[model samples]
Target chain A: MNLLEDTWKLEFHSGIPVYKQIIHHVQAAVAAGRLVDGDQLPTIRALHQQLNVNPNTVAKAYRELQHLGVLSAEHGSGCYIAPGAAEKSDGLSAREKKAKLTDLCARFAAEARSHGISFDDLVAQLKRQHPA
Target chain B: MNLLEDTWKLEFHSGIPVYKQIIHHVQAAVAAGRLVDGDQLPTIRALHQQLNVNPNTVAKAYRELQHLGVLSAEHGSGCYIAPGAAEKSDGLSAREKKAKLTDLCARFAAEARSHGISFDDLVAQLKRQHPA
Candidate 1:
């Protein structure tokens, strides 16, 4: 397969959003040995033109990919499929767990405040339990 | 205490990034009974104007907030603090666990393929273990 080919094979009827389809497409490409490290993806504008979607939608997809560290853009240039992304051994679980824990701690903090417990007091208890 | 105030009290010395600082500011407002649901936050453009930062930087902050379900924008109408955001109990842990499990499965799938085991066979083993 030509490494620089922009053949997305975009699908829109999977009940998943287009951005997600884009994400999965990239993941599938990586898995199937199509796209490799340091591949260049079309810019958001180019993708929007090719996919015939709103710029915001393409931007959203790009944003999601960027958030996942799958792509990076150079200002005045274009987005590139990030190198070494293939070797990333699936840390999504760890990130998801940490986000959940942040939310849990926020909730716990609110609850503790409602119960008139000092932040320090609650922190002490949590530290005692987890010992971090 | 003003609802529309853009007084971020920006703290650059904190270990967290500026965008995260913005997220925490909004979260703290909701938690501390300052900003309520449905409040209108400054637009990314306006925020960039106020903070003297690049539009991309402001957009990045807004995008992060939007990802967290904390903000929504109306075209031609600036971004608004998403309604009912305050009552959102932290589901960080659940999200984290699910992300972790997704990564685990992906790794397993890669390994299974490497070992010449069918995807169905590996999935069957996982289903047997989790029964989910």
Candidate 2:
């Protein structure tokens, strides 16, 4: 899995389409700087082989992203994060930022709670997993 | 989504199947005590309606879980968590426990990092979202 989707695997089940999942992965990666502006994406062939999906699926995702200005394509080279894409992806106002933070916290707490992890252990786990 | 999958929505991406996700959701919930032995599960019809999947898919998931002895069905009443289901779900040996903890931590860190949330904020958010 990419850094954007370490926990989220790419198994298209029922609701979300494969292309949408791919789009979300790239957007999340870009928003976090795992993928910065101008970073080249895997070629269509490489990505389909890596993900074991139809080539058309990857192509469709790239095309949608390009239209969204999250990605730009070179004539021969693979697609790359568009300039200012980070800003576009995050277009978060202050309120949205607060909401996003709250959502993240809720998700983190849920994961810890589901695993029977305590509050102190949860904090400690964060420190261990994400050292400054 | 249930408490077990508040953040991990039912939308299957590309690697996991719908039925498997349901099974995992129940196991996680049972291991965490959100679901306990004898707790009633939604009828297949209720679940299929709630999750908007085919009824057969829900039946298949429940059948598999029953086969694993994680759930039991009554003639008139709905399905319920089987006896000792918790133990079966968490059969995590000591080493497995440590591994699960580490995996949870890594996933937590990845989610926080992707959201650009600071470690301090993550901890604070947990406390706020999950008060003792």
Candidate 3:
């Protein structure tokens, strides 16, 4: 069974492009350890048939993943998760890391605040979600 | 001088649509108390000129805000923040609130974990950013 198809859902009306959504889901799955190194991704045609989305959209997403070094594609053999793909921090410099971290923090802050969640509440929730 | 024009930037290359981006910024500004009730938003034309985006994009954002009760349109007088808009919890059921909060938390978790930040590190960063 293709667990990726069963687990990852596509929101067609999310205003984000379909290809970007696919990229995000694949990265997220990799990060969550749901998809591991050497895991084979559904081919463009199969995914399109399952998703009822354009084949080009799946192809674009796969191309982007390949470009990001998250996936390795063989001309006729389908795509596989690249080794060490979960880390995904290979080429980032210290400054770039800091910048990315800052951006992520800002986004979290904005989202939490927008939802009327206090900073204390956010901290509590995070602690509860990932108890040490 | 419109502070919003100076502060709110649109990232055209981002896969998120322009209208959604505008709605998010407006909501974020209100949530941060930067844009309060009765605050006048830029005219659709003015903002379009300033951002060099299509006027319809600005109009669509304003319309969505109005639909959400975050902004009010007064025909020829431009848009203004709706009364008590900051506490935009008017129409949500308790179950809806929980769902939304869970979604936000999941997104934050995914982002932080994907960046290789430990949950402890994320909590520390949140504390540093929002010291209480």
Candidate 4:
């Protein structure tokens, strides 16, 4: 799990796409200034070994990040972080999404109450995940 | 745009999947107690008219919620909120995601700094979008 440690963690069943998940974690790191540019990402082979996933899957995730301009490979030095990668604005689209999403959730909860679904029951359902 | 209004708002970009985005908004509503279970969704026709999207897309999103047992449509009375539908534990997977995403973004930002990219440049890129 060195690769997992070196990079951000991952969850397979979060319902978010693998590549997007990677992007999210990377973006978060960039925004917070934990990862510096020119840092070498784990090699695809190394990541595959740690995650026990297919090489292609690792490659695909890396490729997606590269497409996002987050990662770049220079000759044999491995993949390095791009400069000035972090910093999405609080007023940008992402922040808007947070606002919209918050509003929607508030409404859904209200509607659920109008229907008589007990709060306890709702909590149970959300916490109860079928084991894989 | 009644359906859109009555429910949550949406955006096509942001890279999050449409269905998941809907789920996110609804989940938030439920968690925050805005949407109760048994709430009827807008008629497929209504949603289609507002978003100008295919009927199947709207149906698909609804069906997903139904499968999660969030909605129960009556034959003629329309969709109503389900009882006690709004509630998910803050400790569950979602909260974890927030943490991981935050961590990742921080790292990415640091990496960018190491590469000598200014924070201003990063902010500009996020705000600038290629027009469709």
Winning model by DockQ: 2
lDDT of 4: 0.53
Error of 4 at A36 (Å): 0.7
Error of 3 at B92 (Å): 20
DockQ of each candidate relative to the true complex: 0.03, 0.22, 0.14, 0.03
Q: iRMS values in order, in angstroms? A: 16.7, 9.2, 9.0, 16.3
lDDT of each: 0.56, 0.71, 0.73, 0.53
Pairs clashing in candidate 2?
Answer: A10-B14, A10-B15, A11-B13, A11-B14, A11-B15, A12-B13, A12-B14, A13-B12
- Which pairs of residues collide in model 3? none
Per-residue lDDT of B69 in model 2: 86
| Fnat across every predicted model, in order | 0.00, 0.50, 0.20, 0.00
For A1-132, candidate 1 gives per-residue lDDT tens digits of 442365666667634568765665665555455666677776777767878888788788777767767677677787777876655434233234334334444554455444333343333233233311
**All candidates: CA RMSD in angstroms?**
15.8, 14.2, 12.7, 14.4
C-alpha lDDT (0 to 100) for residue A104 of candidate 2: 76
Segments of candidate 1 deviating more than 4 angstroms: A1-132, B1-6, B89-132
Q: Could you list the chain B TM-scores for each candidate?
A: 0.57, 0.63, 0.66, 0.55
What 10-residue stretch in candidate 1 chain A is worst by lDDT? A123-132
DockQ of 1: 0.03
lDDT digits (tens) for residues A33-128 of candidate 3: 777889998998988888889999899999988987889988989989999887873334444545676777778887776766546546655655
Off by over 4 Å in 4: A1-8, A87-132, B1-132
**Candidate 3 C-alpha lDDT tens digits along B71-93:** 99999787999999978743444
The most accurate candidate by TM-score is 3
Docking class of 1: incorrect
